[model samples]
Target: MNADNNLYQLYQSIELENVILSYKGEFTSELLTALIHILEAKMEELGTDFRVRKRVFNVIIECFQNLYHHIDFYDFRNEKLEVRKPALIIVKYKDGDFIVNTGNYVMTKDVPKLEKRLSFINTLNKNELRELYLEQLNKGKISSQGNAGLGLIEIARKTKEKLIYNFVKKDSKISFFSLKVVVGN
Candidate 1:
């Protein structure tokens, strides 16, 4: 993925890459509500099975909420919060499955650490992932951004699919982190 300062440019590139569903804008509470509606409609339009729709919705919620809690930014001009930092949700339709692609900006210094955690988690089976998630949650430890970090682990456990991730250098000190998750019917 090409990294640019402009989010619109990122959105365009993702679309050109064959993204089926996307929303590129501020990740406000309002926008999150709209996204739920859009996704619900899209599932209906696609005629996805009821059971599969629920799984899709749950995964999307967890992924977006992670971005909502992390992926920091600030707006100096207006003294406001600029939480709209290049977040995406791409759904790729295949013959018998769907893949969800998501991404946002993360600090370059933290990429290696995050990669290690993701790699370790990816090696675990569903039971191991669940155990790890519960262990972390019981510790009540917070992440660098004050999140529980359990969400990602829980996502992996719930989906039972290997989480695919890549970190691309966006600039001197920041990286663009992307993740792809697959679900089959």
Candidate 2:
């Protein structure tokens, strides 16, 4: 009875938020693909505008790829495998806009660099962002994980909004990074 009540409450909460879809767990490639398909179907069923749907889909892809590549799998000391690399993603509708919120675990040491990058990106105008994106793309800069490091920039470009983020310390070694992007309809 308690479990059922809790589930009902959760469902009501989701309804209140107008959430279209949500996932919380390991972010694997297979799961990413499945999520993309599901979201596409939902968007279609909702009759979302093509441009809005494209922008939202692009940002979601970038967010998921950021989680896939940058998530820390081991402890800060690089000693043992962390039990779970949990991630959360929620797509919701509010005021004729689609909001995407994604959360993942990151190593504490990387937080500063991530903060700096996001801060810099936030300072740019649309034209400046486009120039930077093209410049980076032309350079073909690739990270150790084979990502070109353009996910953040592309996300910002697609959403045309400043990325809202929070880093909550989970422990001494890890922090949970949450990012929110909004796309206007």
Whole-model lDDT per candidate: 0.75, 0.87
TM-score of each: 0.77, 0.92
lDDT of 1 by residue, 149-176 (tens): 6778867865637999999997775689
The candidate 1 region of ten consecutive residues with least summed lDDT is 73-82
Question: Which 10 consecutive positions of candidate 2 have the poorest summed lDDT?
Answer: 70-79
Root-mean-square deviation of each candidate, in angstroms?
A: 5.9, 2.0
Tens-place lDDT digits, model 2, residues 1-185: 99999999999999999998999987788988898899899888888899998899899999998887655434344646646677899999887789999988888888999999999999998899999999999997787667897999999898757999999998877899999999975
Which residue pairs in candidate 2 collide? none
Name the top lDDT candidate. Answer: 2
Evaluated with TM-score, which candidate comes out highest? 2
- Model 1: residues with Cα > 4 Å off, grouped in runs: 1-18, 73-84, 142-146
Cα lDDT for residue 46, candidate 2:
81
Model 1 global lDDT (CA atoms, 0 to 1): 0.75
